[model samples]
Target: MMQLLIVDDEQIEREGMKFILQKSFPSLEVLEARNGKMAIEIAKTIKPDLILMDIKMPGISGLEALERIMEFSTDIKFIMVTAYDTFDYMRKAIKLGASDYLLKPSKAADIVETVGKVLKEIVVDKRSRAASKRQETVIQKTRSIIEADLVTQLLFEHVHEVNVDLLIDMLEIDRNHEVFVMNVLVPDSSDHPYPLIKEKVSELGNCLVGALSGNQLPIIVFRDKNVSFRFQATSFAKKIITVKQHHEALGWFIGIGNVYSELNQVKKSYQESLVAAMEYLSPAKYRFYAEIEIVEEDFFDLRLTTLKKDIVDQIKLGQWEAIRTEVLSLVQFFEQQGASLVYSQQRILEVLWVVSRVLNDLGIEAKSPLFAFQTIDYRQLRMETGQLLDLLKQKHIHYYQQLEADNVQQIKQYIQAHSHEEISLETLSVEMGLSPIYISKLFKEKMGINYIDFLTECRIEKAKKLMQDPRRSIKEIAIEVGYHEPNYFSKVFKKMVHVSPKEYQNAIHGK
Candidate 1:
């Protein structure tokens, strides 16, 4: 079982986390610290695998506490929880190397999923460590046991079935609190969470929850009953925002559910949060329950006129590099605005639509290399707005690279297959069914060599190989590599190789 520690100033938050974490992963051992002093003390003794902690406290803030904990023991991974969305705090946390950031009132689902992913990574790291050891049998046996436990946890509800006290004892919880559930979802697999999720949640109180998996995370926020649910939810949203800014790669979309009166119905809230998130799918990035309708106007200021002009300008000039850069830049801008996944998807679709229209106007086939990507249905992909934007960027870059590779391969194959012919840019263009002018420019840009120089080099190299054999005459070899004039071939060869054919033959034969 993986050991986790929770540190927070509030007793309720600490106890609440323990309940949820215990419920999620019944076999876990949890430890709780009410302040920086107690957290440091626990770290010295418990040495838990993961720590979820708050950034702000009375005496030693979560940030300071994190520093001290790291000083005491560097191995304990931490996730920092903050009620506010302060870039300074995020920058500090990132600089300090906190594993993740979380907002207050994070759901149980989000917590579980995040923790599950971190633990999975930990298990992988442990296995790697064991593999490096000399005792192969013992390592294999230990791995098997752990793997079995993990598989069971994934497949069965045994984690939930375990009694709270037993689970707390297993997890080593030092506090008592109620459990709540948080669920988070995104387009891509978050099976491995950012390591910081554990540390952040631990600080909130106690994350008695299951493992983190994919984009969906279940959290259990432990706060006093007097605390406003909205306040906690707002805090949670801020923390997620901080996470997005720091780990921009995660591309997370967040949602919150109505709080449950008891822990038993916590899963219901998790489900509700999903519905809430799904409702505002069109924004490029989004936080659920932040607004009821997710006013589309907030994220996008769509100007069809400008977007069309940019696409046309890029395509007409063959400015693929600029097009890619601009598209990615737009995505980043929208992500910063907190657009929903649906919003980003729609935005990409709009861009594709405009691009396709431009291609159509130019009499370019919609399915041509320039517009081929539009053929695929992006709706099949289940991802949030930020993630969808990322995919768009990836696809465009990959498409450009693949096109470049194909072009290079075509040029190489054309040269090789027609090596024995009188090959010039014009001749090669005719053979390859391309325009002579376009082929010449493409060869220069793509291969960084001109037609005449490349052909001459090819012909001369063949002549040298033939000369090396001491069988073929220079005249014959010149013809074989498409050189009609032996004298000219000899001169070209001499210029490139700095040796006469006879002298080259003599040197090869040791004459």
Candidate 2:
């Protein structure tokens, strides 16, 4: 309910104004303060929406009380009341932020008009603030969804050319900065610790925490120049571990990857983080990829670069025969180099792991590639590696066999139909029963655009149509096209259409 406070030294004046306000504004709660001193006290405690102060009062003057209240409560509206209509008193009241003024013997209609005007302003201001708060909430939620999808794109799937840059722009992160990946492996299914972990990570520094995919949670940490990489990564990992330490039974593990200057190479860092996470037997709960005792010297040979690319491409293409050829050829090259069978097996295991992860990105949940037993000789090594490849290939084949050819089109239609509602990759993943990573990959490969871009296109197109009607406001058009905040809608529209919504509307009307 609205509250109004009447401050006058005369008991008769306070009572008269209270009765007048109560009769006209039946809903307003009237408060009484006999003097400026009492008025200050009541204003502080009650925080009335409006105050009618008699200009002259005992002890503290009305102007003094208004000034004191103004210091603490700027939102409270004030009106000056006095028998004198002198310029000095009127000027003083105006200087003190009084909204309106009244003569001591004013008519009942005049009193109601002035009080009702300020009351209307208070109501309008309250509604505007509430609307702004709701818009902020919606924008925050949209940013989170975009951040999660960006993490998935960078780490788990191939980056969409059109969407990646736009997503980074929307996230307001530096694209050229170095970044590393961290994999937090939750041992169980409970998601209770995810929010705690994300909150702690945010407090530490800038990072993007992804949604939980199975038990694995990925985070992309931008490099902070103020601290050494080791110190930063170690501190971040330890803090994440502390989140679950109280539970004791959670058994969470963390893996920190090496920092890379390029975003595309971030996937390599993510892969390294997964490899580091596999050091579950280590004494420490967290491990860095560089700290792992893996033989990467031979694995980094320039000769293998082209072959590695070929293997990745072939895996995505599901060219099993070509993939097998590349694997055997890599092993043969290692043998010709006089590399030991153990080293060859290690390198081949790395390749197979990459294949498994790539298949995982394609919606095939292949088991982590591992040899059943150590190969004693090169012959046994080749045989075991072939068996592993065959297993992965069969899973890949089964996945494709069951996937509908029109799945991408169906997803496209769902987005087009629901462009006027909140849509996120996670939501589509749930509805289609596909991993978000796979959905992203499918958009890039089949549609030549990411789903985010497609969704934006749908929204902008709808907004353009709505703009054709001169009767509709930009904010109304924004809501009709799925954006909750008009400013955010304008930004997206401007980014996609090369003009602000107002400019577009003006152009349409020949303004």
Best candidate, TM-score-wise?
2
Cα lDDT of candidate 1 equals 0.60
Which runs in model 2 stand beyond 4 Å of their true positions?
Answer: 1-140, 153-157, 160-162, 176-178, 185-197, 211-216, 242-253, 260-283, 292-325, 328-346, 367-390, 400-511
Pairs of residues clashing in candidate 2: none
TM-score of each: 0.33, 0.43
> In model 1, what lDDT does residue 442 have?
75
lDDT of 2 by residue, 1-511 (tens): 5689988888898888888888766557899888888888887888998999888887998888999999999989998987764547878889889988998699998998788777767655554555577856655565567678889878754555545655665566777789999988775634467778878887886888888775678999989889999999989998898887644544477888999996667888997887677654346788888976554465545535665567667876878888888788878877887886655775677677677767776678865665655578888888888999999998887777556447887898899999998888999999888999989988888778998899999999998998899999999999888989999999998999999999999999999
Tens digit of per-residue lDDT, candidate 1, span 284-351: 34444434444354334464446666876677666656655555555565566766544554454445
Q: Please report the TM-score between candidate 2 and the true structure.
A: 0.43
User: Model 1 Cα displacement at 479 (Å)?
Assistant: 1.5
Local lDDT at 152 for model 1: 30
